[model samples]
Target: MIVENKEFHSRICVDALENAKSVFSPLSSEEKQLLLEQMIAHEFKKGEVIYRVGEKPDGVLYLVHGKAKIAKAGIGGREQIVRMAGVHSFIGYRALFAEEESYASATTLEETFLVQLPFETVVSVIRSNSDFALALLKSFATDLRFAENRTVTLTQKHIRGRLAESLLLLHKEYGVGDDEQTLQVLLSREDVAKFSNMTPSNAIRTLSAFAQEGVIALEGRAIKILNIDELERISRLG
Candidate 1:
């Protein structure tokens, strides 16, 4: 559900840009203001595809609220979840910088808000602001490292370890709910399977097994970690 683009001065749009200050912290006040003035804000409903694979990016997207997943379509139309983006995260910039079509799609996990800095503006900043360019390079490096680590984990880890690590990864990204136990992000079993690199049925059975082992408690889509230490141990052993 994409909303009509809003002016930067609109309250919601302003708030969204406020949440993304860290990304522009390297810019001077005037440059930051100019960038924000040129940004366009968009809202997407849960399950909406933000961008599809092979689409050309027009701008760099900054996730201001809610969650999103970056995924690539696999065999039989299955999607492999490559990365999860939360508030203050950037998406679509890699393709923009590389001048290539998006290799993966981005979808909203919940009602999401984002601000897009135009491609020309971003390129201008990168050329003029040395610190900003370096910061983006560092961010790229960090993402590469995480992808390399996840590739190893998904390929080599057993089912139990994979599931456990996926849950931990969710916790790290979204933190706990009000009870400080239930995961804040609610995902379907299939989404979990994609993220963990397993079949949906296998993910279900392993989740049930973990519940039986007193490592986690499940209520609908909410997964509560009952024993963090045990969960970590299983992930480590694999």
Candidate 2:
């Protein structure tokens, strides 16, 4: 379930809107204040669906805290994770910009906080601010580049290489824990398989192989990179 947080004036929400990469950053103070007044803040529990495939976007979504995954369901009800979003990231904007229903679903990986900017308000700002429009275009271009790279990784890489790359990606996005080895984010085995574009059994086998090779250490959902160089080599060779 999702809870609507009435305290939209919280510092995190304000920072999310005013941050350098924010779409609303180019607006004047008065404009931003007005926009904030119309925004809604939502808190979602771990595993809760933020939005589902085919749903119409009500607004622009900006993550203020926690992690989430954007994925699409495939044949036989299999899921393929397209991307993982962290704090300060934007999700669902692609469909909103295209004026179409969402092609993928977004779900929280942990307890998450988000600020939603009303669609009409965002549209009005884009029309009045050329800089904001350009920013949006740049964001679109960056997302396209990532999509292109991921397409190659999923199709061309071997199972081992795919899992290695997925682990590396998680390390990059969430970084390490206090030990400087274990990843901070913990994802279920199914999520790992979906993100790596492989079946759960395949993913599990590959992970065990890596563990035996001393490339990584796994403790339940916690993954520790014991040999970053070897992991990178696998990804590069694939």
Candidate 3:
């Protein structure tokens, strides 16, 4: 859930800016301040749609806190998750740069906070700053590489491999909780299936199999890694 404290919101927004050092570092102090002034903070509840396919990109959305799932629907209304993004990243920017409608949808995986910078302001700043433009280009390249890798994984991997890789990916993204074993982000079976590109029933069965094999433990929505080596081996085997 989003904290209601305005002070906390402002603090995290600053933190998010700090975390994005590569992007903001290129700007002059005055330019940074000007861009910060134009930012507007927004909070979204779990499962809320941040943006949808066919929507015109109005601004670049910076995720300040919590997680979001980016996905595209396929035939028969199935969802194929493109990726999950957390704090200290920008969303909806590719569409904004392309001057086209969003090609995919972004939804809040949990209560999330974001700061939106106007598209016009972003364009203006990029036009004025070569460093910032180069940084954005690098970000786009990174995402494109990730998309290419995911395409290979989904097409070549078996169900066991796919789910194992997904688990490893989630751990890489959200990390572990204070227990250092339980996953920080709690995803429902359906969400996991969508992210893994499998049917919900198959996802559930595979998760149960993992538990039975002593690779993981499930307690409600929490998943604890019991055998990291084994899980990684399964992921790599595919």
TM per candidate: 0.93, 0.91, 0.92
Q: Write the per-residue lDDT of candidate 3 for residues 155-189, one digit (tens) a residue.
A: 89999999999999899889998888999899999
How would you order the candidates by lDDT, starting with the best?
2, 1, 3
lDDT of 1 by residue, 114-183 (tens): 8787889888988999998897788778788989999999999999999999999998889997888999
Q: All candidates' lDDT scores?
A: 0.86, 0.87, 0.86
Looking at candidate 3, what is the lDDT of residue 155?
Answer: 87
Clashing pairs in 2: none
Number of the top TM-score candidate: 1
lDDT of candidate 3 at residue 219, scale 0 to 100: 99
**What lDDT score is found at residue 113 in candidate 2?**
86
In candidate 2, residue 164 scores what lDDT? Answer: 92
Instruction: Judging by lDDT against the true structure, name the best candidate.
Output: 2
Q: What's the count of clashing pairs in each model shown?
A: 0, 0, 0
Candidate 1 regions with alpha-carbon error over 4 angstroms:
1-9
